[model samples]
Target chain A: MEPGYDLPAMIGMTEADVQTPALILDLDALEANIARMAAEARAMGVALRPHAKMHKSADIALMQIAAGAVGVCCQKVSEAEALVRAGVGDVLISNELRDGVKLARLARLAGRAQVAVCVDDAGGVAELAAAVAEAGTGVRVLVEVDVGAARCGVAPGAAAVPLAQAILAAPGLTFGGLQAYHGGAQHLRTEAERAGAIADVVGKVRQTLAALEAAGIAVPCVTGAGTGSFRHEGASGVYTEMQCGSYAFMDADYGRNLDAGGAWTSPFRNAMFMLAGVMSKTRPGHAVCDAGLKVMSMESGLPVSAREGVEYVGASDEHGTLADPGDVLRPGDRLRLIPGHCDPTVNLHDWYVGIRGGVVECLWPVTARGKHF
Target chain B: MEPGYDLPAMIGMTEADVQTPALILDLDALEANIARMAAEARAMGVALRPHAKMHKSADIALMQIAAGAVGVCCQKVSEAEALVRAGVGDVLISNELRDGVKLARLARLAGRAQVAVCVDDAGGVAELAAAVAEAGTGVRVLVEVDVGAARCGVAPGAAAVPLAQAILAAPGLTFGGLQAYHGGAQHLRTEAERAGAIADVVGKVRQTLAALEAAGIAVPCVTGAGTGSFRHEGASGVYTEMQCGSYAFMDADYGRNLDAGGAWTSPFRNAMFMLAGVMSKTRPGHAVCDAGLKVMSMESGLPVSAREGVEYVGASDEHGTLADPGDVLRPGDRLRLIPGHCDPTVNLHDWYVGIRGGVVECLWPVTARGKHF
Candidate 1:
């Protein structure tokens, strides 16, 4: 089925004519970011698997594939199903899946694409094996070790060995090595802190690899890294695959990350914007915009204004209050807002209006939006 | 168009068989809340126009209208259009519309339904008049007065007169009285604070009405009140309409609100839940659920767990971390999570699995889930 309405913009319209509270993509910057990441991954001798969880657009995924990305990484089976249906040939379910229905769906989806999933428990491995056997499909399974992020995965070193052995013993499943990711360490404020976190992650991954080797299991690939700390992982000589998603569309939260010189990292530019229109300017020092928490996720933080002297102060359900001390904003004025976080914010919209040279270039559907199951 | 996939669950399926991270509604609690609000509105001698911006479901709006509501209130033109297309007879755009494209759409939408919109500027009045004239349709225009929420609306009292007069002078427009809403007042921690804020709102609305009366203008309806402070507005003797939306599906944020006796309010029960499945249980005192920020909004706060000894602590893109102090949760275990905020949380899913007697009875689409433009 298609979306309930038309696309947010046409192919030839100007940016000014595009609808408010729409996701706007800078096409020039997006292409540059994609090319840069591909080149960097090649230089580091690691396979690039851009996470589709950030953009959720099949068109962008195809572009990354054409630019030498191995495949895309998604978090859920439904998301992988959407992307696979849209011709994303290879997908990695980066997190664990324990529900039987989802496992069955994943097993069926594996028939259409090269599908893999991560698991930290033997019970999950058994359930996945049953689903794959029922569907008569072969699927890859990765042993997820808790490198640093304490939220998911089993304990790092020897804890990954049992899950690997379980996957190897299963008939329809293949051992796909370890999934080691430190989500919290990706957002460390300083480069030194981030490097230290990745150093710890590399040590844990090495210990897991030693345990697998001792068990006579040959590890194929180890994947885990994000936009914030991919450089460290790429240079570590241990990570075989990189799963960086948000590098293509940098956000305010990432913009706050510092480099070795104590300046904002220059590897990527902000390529996506939440384009909002001022609908109310009644208050003297404040103006209300059409974008709010419904249109853009504020869980990370409030969006940063692209224009100087105008700061986004607060957000409600349907309105964003701007601290426009200069009182320069008026009704119908459009503003490009840098979202605080890229992933959940992109999930809030249906389409992305790609613009270049101030003109609409393309429109892509967020194919995997709301596919959280 | 239909959604990209099939419904999460079929009728007659048990709650346990439904997909993870799906929106579940308790039909009994929903019916009770609707009946209670309808009776309260009747006793208060005011019209009920439940806000569709919260639920965004035509089925619920129809249920309210069937019970005795005059119509429904929405925050966007696209939202009103979606509801109207779904057979809702009447809708009010409770927020301002300044963009010409949206104004034209709203004007065209009025041709098929009883449509009204709020405005605070004379320029907005002119634009609405032009759009209505172009479409050859009439729409009701309410002068939005700044009653306590400083985000939108003009200053209260005399500031509303010129806009009301402009609406009277415009073609294809009718002056529909004042839109006086105190959004910030609704969430005040204490009952006394909410009452004080609403009292101030009543005073401002009263001043605006007196000014309009002095100018020989007749006010037809005074609209605005949410679930948080609707009691104060209902008893204010100034508000003619109450727009309580969350009362239909109470959330954790609203559950924190205190009554006059320093207890949780007893008027509404939580009728909605985000049904999730535990995907990982590797840690000693923690488990990861399939639902996270992508499935449920976390701007208001983390979701409240329905089961004892389990608390939703942190959320990433696709995983919810649960603090399971008793370590009772295991992989594939189901959970009923009360969302932090009802409105945006409902916006994250495509369908609502309505449960009655532990079985799925109905599946209602969130008709206006992403109609933010």
Candidate 2:
């Protein structure tokens, strides 16, 4: 229904005039955030592979690449395909890929670009190799190492060796080094916690690197670090790359993290916002907004209202309750909500109404949205 | 990207052959659910206006209407617009709508078919009335009452009179009585709790009806109730129309609702499922699937694995952790997850792959998806 609808007709409207329940991107904040991150990565001598899973937009990936990022990282093959089709020549899927269908798509996508993927299981190597052979192209395989987050990936030391060896054994696969991402570190509240988490991960990476070198394999790359701990890992001599994605779009969860001085200051500015309208304010201090869980992600926590004197208390399917002090918000008043989590929250909208100088600069379709497969 | 990609190329394929992270609707379960709800509403003599927010699909609405439903109720104006475009007439937007943009679109929509909306604010009435007058059409405006939700509604009794009177005073607006939905009772867990909650709401509705009648305003309709507590409200005689959604697709939250003997048995079956692929199983007694928060709604709770020996323990952005006891699921094995909540979970996907006899029978686009505006 939206394909036929005039979704892009709001291109020239001002921020205040654009329709509510729209995903608004502050282009100035976005450019500043990107430039700062690129400068930091270049200074630290680490390649920046911003995760596409965060923005899920090919347009954002292009901007990052232009800002000196070494391609992008995706969590799914479909996302990689979208980026590749949109002319992103280099991509590293930070997550593991199995299942014949996805592997074949990844292999096909490799023909369009320099495609790489992470692996933790030996059985997955043969399937990926077979798909690559069918596609008549090769894919770089990074053996994922579990540094902290007890999620996908092999244990950080010698456990990843067998997977690396299997990738080397495959004819159409190139054994790229370790893919170690400590996802839990991205939400560490304090500087000490974020730094300590990355420090331990660096120690494990050292052990993994030594083990791989002893096995007569050259460890080419060690890519891992998120928005919360990327600075820590960027300074580490052992790390080769920082996969910071959320730095491009600061969320409420990341905003909660403390800096070195124990103050709430980050290098990045919050560029992503959900524009909602006040739909009801019948009660004295109570109000309801049009955006809710279907439009905003509430995993980390509820969105912090950008408006003063108003508090977002709760949300249902399509209604969000706001505790407005003395009814500050009436019907038709637009409110900006800083989402707690950017990745999934961005997934909720179809178009990002890019705003610059209070004017709608562009309307980029969230191209890779709903591409879970 | 999906329009070019063959997403439904697996139409005649079995469940194992279907793609990962797809919203699968079991045709058998769906038909049975529709029949059961239609039968129950018939027995109770309540007009069934199943909420389209649960499915957000006009195809499902047409099916409900075919099975003896008085059209459907939508929570958002865009949803109602899509359903009307698809030829499902008589839509009652069960939530309050403000803002000129939405009201104008809604007014335009009312010209296509029978459109009704709820109002809780007098200021909203002026704008809605302006839009209706411009459209040269009239709309049934139901004065929303705060029926224990603590969300978007005026107080039930005389407090609702001013809004009702305003709706009556507005030219091109027809006062359609009270929109009293006890949202809390939907998840009250016990039969007595749900029944008691609705019983209290009934008393409030009676008072509101008296107040409206005394003010010379005729309360034409009183529509409320959901799949969880629809039975209780339908029997309450005060509720003339039932807005029960989720009966077509029962989720884990509804599955947790207890029946007469405190056993987990609702008349409806668990039909809506997120078909996920086991993407990783590197650790013993643990596995990871391809579906997570991006695919299922975690608000009601995390999804439950349909497989007997496996359990979904946690989820991240793009992956869900499964505690597989006994080393059952391997990478590439597909499993269905019963989502915790049906409404927002359905909002996560773009297409619903309808399955019948272990084969993909149809693929319906979630047409109104991401239509929050």
Candidate 1 stretches with Cα past 4 Å from truth are A1-5, B1-6
- Model 2 lDDT tens row, B1-373: 1223537326777888777888999999999999999999999998898989889998999999999998899987888888788889989998877766678888888889899999887787888999999888889999888888899888878888888889888999998888999787888888888888888988989989988888888887899998878877888888889998988998898888886796444588888899999889988899999999998879789998899989999999999999988999899999999999988989988889999998888888887898787
Candidate topping DockQ: 2
Model 1 chain B poorest ten-residue lDDT run: B1-10
For the predicted complex of model 2, DockQ is 0.68
TM-score, model 1 to reference: 0.98
Give per-residue CA lDDT, model 2, range A202-221, as digits (tens). 99999998888888888889
TM-score of chain B of 2: 0.96
- Residue A102 lDDT, candidate 2, scale 0-100: 84
The residue pairs that clash in candidate 2, if any, are none
iRMS for model 1?
Answer: 3.0
lDDT of 1 by residue, A314-369 (tens): 99999999999999998999999999999999998889999999999898999988
| Chain A TM-score values, per prediction | 0.97, 0.97
Model 1 per-residue lDDT tens digits across residues B1-373: 1122446888888988888889999999999999999999999999999999999999999999999999999999899999999999999999899988899899989999999999989899999999999999999999988887878999988989999999999989999988888888878889989989998999999899999999999999999998989989999999999998999999999999997786555888999999999999987889999999998889889999998999999999899999998999999999999999999998888899999999999999999999988
Q: What is the C-alpha lDDT of each candidate?
A: 0.91, 0.87
